[model samples]
Target: MTDLLETLIENREMVQPNHANMLEVAHGGNVMKWMDEVGAMSAMRFSGETCVTAQVNRMDFERPIPVGDTAYITAYVYDAGTSSVKVRLITEREDLRTREREKTTESYFVYVAIDDENRPTTVPKLTVDSETGERLRQDALEGEIDGNSDKS
Candidate 1:
């Protein structure tokens, strides 16, 4: 079984003027788009199949990234179901000139594997094989716990 964190993926996007809204910061839509892309990548890496976004649990914009900064997006599979992979999307802002990083946003996204016919397909079971993988699994468990708590 492949561990979720073993599928860690990272990508960076320069926040261009067009990516900003009226606030001169990266627009929410742009952030969402980046998150979706990274989340899908993580799912694809884990499932070894094409994956599509099924849902986004919640996206919280904890901070803003300016147009001149670089958006660093990181994603890793957190959990899996019969046909879905859960991933966490973390976005950070790095000052390109100064090399400083600050978290910008985070979200939980779920993706489903699809076959050639676009039908949902099963994914491989996940295993926590290393210390970091174990920690990521625990973090995913905490997210589950938080979700359950939010229901009540």
Candidate 2:
């Protein structure tokens, strides 16, 4: 069984003018595209099978990544279902001049494993053996909190 806690993948891309919007920041759609791709890759690496995006929970853009900067996207599988995997994606913007980075976006995505025939396939249960894995598991659970729920 592959350890899901320590598993991670990082990808970097240079933000270009074409990727920006009228405000001169990376477009929300472009960022979403990057996240989806990275999340799918992480799910495939963990499950060892092809996977497709089933759903994406609220994706919050915390900050804007300006053009000419580098965007670093990292993904990890935090939960696994019978035929689905949940991935956490973090997007950060690295300033080229000052050498600083700021988190620009965060999101949770669920992917369904697929067979060679493109049908849903079952995936192995996730095992977390380290602190990182445990933390990720906890984060996943906490993220399930319904923000819209009314409580006294």
Q: Show how many residue pairs clash in every candidate, following the order shown.
A: 0, 0
Sequence-dependent TM-score of model 1: 0.92
lDDT of 1 by residue, 77-152 (tens): 8789999999877788999898999787877889999999999999999887888887766776676557532210
| Model 1 alpha-carbon miss at residue 54, Å | 0.5
Worst 10 residues of 2 by lDDT: 143-152
lDDT of 1: 0.85
Off by over 4 Å in 1: 147-152
Cα lDDT tens digits for candidate 2, 1-152: 77875458899888999999999999999999999999999999999999999998988888899999988998888888889999888889998789798888888899999999999999987888988778766776576455221111
Those runs of model 2 whose alpha carbons end farther than 4 Å from true positions after fitting are: 146-152
Give each model's whole-structure lDDT: 0.85, 0.85
Model 1 residue 82 lDDT?
Answer: 97
